[model samples]
Structures are given as structure tokens and as C-alpha cells.
Target: MTDCIVVGGGLIGMLSARMLHDQGLDVTLLDRQEPGQEASWAGGGILSPLYPWRFPDPVTHLASLTQAAFPSFADELLQETGEDPQWTQNGLLVLDPGQWDVAQAWARRWPDVQLEALDQPAVHGCEPALAEGFDQGVWMPRVAQVRNPRLMRALQHSLVRRGVDIRPRTPVSGFRVRSGRVTGVITEQGELLAERVVVAGGAWTGGLLLSLGAPPIEPVRGQMILFRGPPGLLSRMVLNDDQYIIPRRDGHVLAGSSLERVGFDKSITEAAAQTFREAAARLVPALADLPIEKHWAGLRPGSPQGIPYIGPHPEVEGLFVNAGHYRNGVVMSIGACRLLTDLIMGHAPICDPSPYRIDRADFSVRRSNAN
Candidate 1:
């Protein structure tokens, strides 16, 4: 029998499957569609949260652990799969001078987080393409980003090479529960028997868990636009207000995004595209002249207070959950995978798992049968 059956083949699910397999567990990963084509591929790949201080301790803690593990994780992927995710350490520039004090406080709270106040000239020196009027900003030197699509591809390749049973287009319809223990997963194709099952479904996690009596996970659609520009036009990722501009190594400048609670609709609207375009132009005036290469949207699995459910189900034996990461799925994947793996293997976790426990009061499922 498969030791573990991981539902949802996004970054979290794929990584969790790989981690479980590495620990000598026979693993099978199931996805509704092709793996890594959802929010995991659509993200901007920022290694840290947009405003680290704004989030609670749980979010920041997971992000910190993931950030520290990313370098080695990327290195290992490169060594194994010979595919580079283009992990770049160009840092992030926060243009909201109004939050300078708050950002400074965050830096003080975290000794490892390096935040520096930049004058107008310094801002220009870092990203000359930025529009004028940005007099001062916060520069986080430790911030980094990875190409999301490439990272997903590398993980998929690595997982396959590691002998993981990855099943794309396999939609999990329900769970086989005997007494209180989950015996296996009921997919569209057939029953997948396993000793343990993990629900890592992204935006669809809520629906998948509803029958099993779990918390509701909603889909928050985020629209993004890609601008093709000359290389070296924008060197660092720039965040102004809620929008951000990410510059890739290949002269593809990604400007996004609009957080709309529009369910699982991935359709891009003209208004959203225009909004992204304007935001990008504001960040870097030269981007106004650049051609928009693409426009798309992805559904982020949002949760209350932005904390993901990352532990075993309270009442369901042999069932675990790692979904509802919202926008930080890419950034928090490594730490989350580690935590879930440790829990499944009965090993002491590298970090405290209390905050991410599924049984937390705030994370309780709303369904009547959830208890």
C-alpha cells in the first residue's frame, strides 16, 4: 500500500510528496489538472512576504524558515534535475515611505532581517527606471525571488526522478473513512489506498475537505501582467502599496497584482490589466513604453488571518492538511514541507508546529460535522 497519498499537486503537495518519499514512505501525488500550473506557477516568487511586519508571528516565522532553506533547496534541485529555477538575491524595495517607521521596527525585531532606509538618490541608483517622486524607501537586502514556473518545473522533474507517483489530471472526489480513520482517497479514476492522506489542494482544498469536515478554504483571484523590457531596466523587485514589479533575468518584467475575492475564476479583465499596467508604469516609467507580453490570473487559497492549516486533522485519523497558504505558498513551501514531513514521520519538527496546527481555534472548520 502507498504509505501516503498527497492530494493537490501544487508546490506544497509536490514538495510534501518528495519529502515523504525521502523518508522511505511510498507516496502518490494527485492533482485536479496538470501539476504546478495553478497559483504555484502564477506567483511572483518573492521569497519573503510583501510586508513582513504586517503579518502575525506565524506567517513571519514560516517565511523566515523557508527563506533560509531556499538557497540549499534550490542548489539541491539544480544538482539533481539540472534545471535552474533562477533564484535571484536582488532584494526587495518597499516604496511606501509612510511605513518607514513600521519597517524599521520590524528590522529591529528580527536581527537577521536587514532593512536600510534609502534616500531618493539611492533608490534611483538601485533602480533608475523607477518613476521620480519616490524620495525615500525601505530596502531589504536579504530579500530574494525565484522564477515560479521554473521552480515548479524543477521540482516536478526532481520528484519524478525520485520515483514519486505523480498523477496529473487526477481529481480527488472524496476520502474513504473507516470509523474515524481515513483509509484512502477516492479519486475520479479509482480508489488510492494509503496509510495516511494529506490534503494540500490549493484553492480547491476547502471543497475537497468539506465532505471530510474541514475548514473552508476560499479562492482569491490575483491578476498579473507581464511586460517585456530591455535587460537591466529594473534590477530589484519594487513594492509600492499593494502592487509589485518583479524583474526577471531574461528582461521580462512582471507587474501585478489585483487581489479580488472572485472565487476560482481565472479570467483576466481589461480593468485588472489596466490597473496592473498603471501600477507598473508608476513603479518604472519606462515600463509604460514596454509591450505587455501576457496577462493572466491565478486562484490563491486564502484563509482567515493568512495562516495556513499545516497539521493533521483533529478528528480524522491518518489525514493531514497543508493548504490555504494564500499568496505565500511559494515562499513558505520549504518550511511547510519540512514541518509536515516531520509530523508524519514522528520526528521532532525543526520549528514549533503549534501556530500552524489544524485544530487552532481560528482555523476551525465551519461545517457542522467538522467536530
Candidate 2:
């Protein structure tokens, strides 16, 4: 029998499968489509919380731990899968109207981070493409990024090589519950019996849970755009207001993103596309001349009180959940998976999992109540 059956083959699910496989568990990863082709691929690749100070402690703490894991994780993925998950430490430049006290307040709050105020000339010297006459900006030297899509690919390849049975195009319909404990899952193809089952279905996690008579979760759609530009166009990732611009070493500029509660609608809009282009142009005028390589959207899983729904399900035994990562899914994957793994093994997690537990009151609110 498979020791663990992990549903949802995205970053979180794949990571959970890998960790379990490492512990010598018989693991099988099932997904509706190819793994890592969802929100994990359609992301800005910003490894840091764009506005950490604005978020609560749980989000900040988990994100920080996951951010610290990227450097070494990237190297491990490359060595194991022969895929270079380009981890870039180019930092982030946050620009806003100098008149806004919120931005300045946040800059001051994060003293541990190198938040330097940059003037118009200083910004221009750093990137000639920036719009002139900006009042002030904050430069976070510790901010970093990873090529998210590449990392997902590496994880999938590595998991399979490590003896994980990955089933792409396998949609899980619901779970097999016996006497309040989950026995296995009922997929579109067939039934899978396992000792334990984990749900990492991303945006669709809540619906999947409801089908199993489990609690609810919701999906928030995040739209993004990608542009192809010449190399050296940008030396760092940048954010201003609701927009962010991420550049690749290979001359591709990822401009994003807009958050919408449009309910699982992963379709791009002309207005959103225009908004992104305008925002990118405002940040770096040269982006206006670059050709857009792609425009797409992905549904991000969001939980109530804005914390990730990670850990065991309260009402069910032998079933677990690790979704609702919203925006920071890529950054929070490792730390979140580590906590979940520890919980599954009946061992105490090094970091407190209470903040991200599925049974938390915040997650059990109306937001988590709704399917």
C-alpha cells in the first residue's frame, strides 16, 4: 500500500511527496494537469513578501523561513535534477510617492533589512530606464528571487527520480472516509487506498475538501504579464503600489500583477493588461518598448485571516491540508511542507505550526466556512 497519497501536484504537493519519499514513504502525487503549470508557474518570482510590514506575524514569519531556504534549496535541486532553478539575489526596489507615510513607516519598521532611501538621481544611476523625478524609494538589499517555473520543473523531476509516482491529469473527485478517518481518495480514474492522504490542491482545495465533507477554502485569481527585453534591462526586482516588475538574466521581464476576487476566472483582461503595461512603463519607461511575450492568470488559494491552511484537518483523522498560500506560495512552500511533514510523523515541528494549523479559529471563520 502507498504510505501517503498526496493530492494536488503543485509546488506544495510535490514538495510534500518529496519529503515523504525521503523518509522512505511510498508516495503518489496526483494532479488535474501537469504539475507546476498553475500559479506556481504564473508568478512574479519575488521570493520576499512584497509588503511584509503590512501583513500579520504568521505570514511574515513563515515567509522569512521559506526565503532563507531558497538559496540552499536551489543548489540541491540543481544537483539532483540537473536543472538550474536560477536563484537570483538582485534585491527589490520599492517606489512610492514620497508623500505617503505608509511606505516610509514600513521602511523604518524593517530595520533588520537594508532599507535605504534613494533619490531621483540615485534611482536613475542604478537603472537609467526608471522614470525621472521620483521623490524617494526604498531599496531592500536582502530581497531575492527564484525562477519559479524552473524550480517547479526541478521539483517534479526530482520527485519522480526519487521514486514518487506522479500522475498528471489525474483529478481527485473526493476522499474515502471511514469512521471519521480518511482511507483514500476517489479520483477520476479510480480509487486510491493509503494510510494517509494530504490535500495540497491550491485554489481548488476548498472545493475538494467540501466534496469530502471537509472544511471550505477559496481561490483568488492573480493575473500577470511577461515581456521580453534585452539583457541588463533591470538589475533588481521592483514594486510600486499594486505592480511589480521582475527581470531575468536572459532578457525576459516579468510584469505583474493584479489581485481579483473574480472567482476562479483565470482569464486575462485588456484592462488588466493595459494596467500592467502602464505600471511597468511608469517604473521603467524602456519596458514600454519591449514586446510582451505572454499574458496569463492563475488562481491563488486564500484562507481566512490571510494565513496558510497547513496541518491536519480537525474533523478528520489521517487527512491533512496545506493550501491557502495566496501570493507567497512559492516562498512559503519549503517551511510549510517541513511543518506538515513533522506533524504527519507525529513529531514536534522545530517551528510552531499553530500559526498555520488548519484548525485555527481564524481559518475556521466564515471564509473557511464557505466552500
Candidate 3:
């Protein structure tokens, strides 16, 4: 019997499994599709949320913790796997001067986060590729990004080296619960008994939890487009309005994304592609001539008020959750993993887990025995 079974293979699940293994637990990670091919692979890899002030306190807290730990985390991964995840601290430029005041307030609240007000010339100097815009912006010099695909690959490699039972393409059918305690998981192959189970199923987490009378998680589809442009054309991430353009170490630029409520549809619509293209071109005119490299969509796990469920199930013993991260899974993965591991191992939590508790009063998951 495995000591723990993590029932999702995305960033959250994989990180959770790694942490559990580090704690000397017998861990097995099961995924329906290949691990990390879901939202974890599709995100733009921004280390910080687009607008920190706009989110709830819980979101900001987790993001801040992860952002601080990212450099060391990426370095450790690179040293272990010999694969560079390219942790770039090129900064983030918010082109909307209208949000300057709110951004300043948030920065003040967290003195550690560096925020600078910039004039038109400064914005242009920071990113000359940007289209001729009317003046002012905000610069967050402390903001960073990672090459998510590489990061995922490094984590998978490290986990494999650590002897984790990383089971890809293994779909979990249901949970084996007896007297309110989860005894094991029922997968397509067979029953795997475990003392504890964590549902890190991303967008599918809600449905899995709903089977055991938990709150349903909604899938928010985001479509993104990639552009191959001249290398060194853009130095930093540019955010204007609600759209963003992220530059990789190479000449590749990622422009995204359209948040659609259409359930589980990974189809890339022409309209979304056009919207992304227009946004990219508007942000950096040179991108207009650049070749369209790729277009795809991913499902983000959506929950109430943009906060995720990260604690144990209210009613189900031996069950835990680390899902509903929505678009911030990459940003929150490390902190979430640490917190979840602490809870499962009965150690003092790294942060107060009250904000991310599954049984918050405002949001309640419906309980049912019917599968």
C-alpha cells in the first residue's frame, strides 16, 4: 500500500508528490493523460499574477511566497536535472496608467515588492518594441518568469530520480471510501490502497470531489497564441488592458489569452487567435510580421473569488486537496506544495492555511453519496 496517492499529474500534483516523497512517504502520482500536458504546460509562465492588487489577499500571499522562493527553486532544479528552466527576472511593465494608484497601494502593503512609476520614455526605453503609446506605466522590476515546459520536465526528471511512482496516462475512475475515510483509489487498472489521497486534478478536481459530496470546480478555458520574432526584440513582459505579451529567452513571444467559460473545450477559436494577434501586434508592432508559431488552449481550475482550495476535505477523512488554483497554479505551486505537505505530515504549516481551507463559510461544496 502506498502511503499517499496524488490523483493528478499537473504542477500541483507533481510538486505535492515530490514534497511527500521528500518527507519519506511512499507516493504514487496518477494522471489521466500525460503529466504536465494540461494547464501546467500551457500557461505563459509568469511568476506573478497580472495585477496583484486586484486579487484577494489569499492570492497575493501565496503568489508573494512563491515569487520569493522561485529563484532558489529553479536553481535547485537546474543543479539536480542539468536542465535550465530559464528563471528570468526581466521585470513586468504594466502599460495601463489608470491602475498606477492601486498598484502603488499594493506595493506599499508589501514593501519587499519593488514597483516603479514610469513615464512614456521610460516605458519605451524598457521595451522599445512596444507600439507608440500615450505615456505612463508601472514597472515591477522584481517580477520574474520561468520556462514552464522546461520546469515541468526538470521536476519530472528529479521525481523519477527520487523513485516516485509517476504513473502517466492512468485515469482515476473513483475513490474507495469506507466510513468517511478514503481507503484507496479505484483507477482504470486496479485498486491502489493508500492511507491518504490528494485530489490535484486541476479543472477536473471539482467533478472528482463532487462524487464524494465536495464543491464542484469550474473549468475556465484560456486560449493563447505564440509568435516567433527576432531575438532580443523584447526584453520584458508587457501588460496592457487585460492582455499580456511574454518573451522567452529565444526570439519566441507568447501572446494570450481569452478567458472563456465554455466547459472543457480545448478548441482554439479563430476569434480568440485574432484577438491575441491584434493584442500582440498592438503591444509590439514588430510581432505583426512575425510568424505565428502556435495556438492552443488550456483549462484553468476556477474557484470562488479567485482563491484555490488547498486543505483537507471537510467531511472526508484521509483526503486532501490542492486544486482550484485557476490561472495562478504556476505562481502558487511551491507554496501550495509546502503547505499541503505540512498538513499531510502533521507538521506546523508554513503559512496560516485558514484562507485556503476547503470548508470556508462563504463557499460550500455539496455532499452526495451517489457516484
Give the lowest summed-lDDT range of ten residues in model 2: 360-369
Tens-place lDDT per residue, model 2, 179-227, is 9988999987889999999999999887787744444457788888889
Residue-level lDDT of model 1, residues 1-371, one tens digit each, is 78999998889999999999999999999999999999999999999988888988888888888999899999899999999998899999999878889978877877778888899999888788788899998899889999999999999999999999989899988999999999999977889899999999999987898865666579999989999888888899999988999999989999988889987789999998898888888888889999999998999999877889888898889999998898899888888889999998999997899988876343353565455
Query: How many residue pairs of model 3 clash at the backbone?
Result: 4
Better of 2 and 3 by TM-score: 3
User: Candidate 2, 304: how far from true, in Å?
Assistant: 2.5
Task: Give me the runs in candidate 2 sitting further than 4 Å from their true place.
Answer: 98-112, 211-216, 360-371
Q: Give me the runs in candidate 3 sitting further than 4 Å from their true place.
A: 360-371
Q: Using Cα atoms with residue i matched to residue i, what is each candidate's TM-score against the true structure?
A: 0.97, 0.93, 0.97
lDDT of 1 at 136: 93
| lDDT (Cα, tens digit) per residue for candidate 3, span 81-181 | 99888999999999986888898888888878898889989889888888896499989998999988899999999899999998988898899999999
Give all candidate RMSDs, comma-separated: 1.7, 2.5, 1.7
**C-alpha lDDT of candidate 1 relative to the true structure:** 0.89
TM-score of candidate 1 on Cα atoms, chains taken together:
0.97
lDDT of each structure? 0.89, 0.82, 0.89
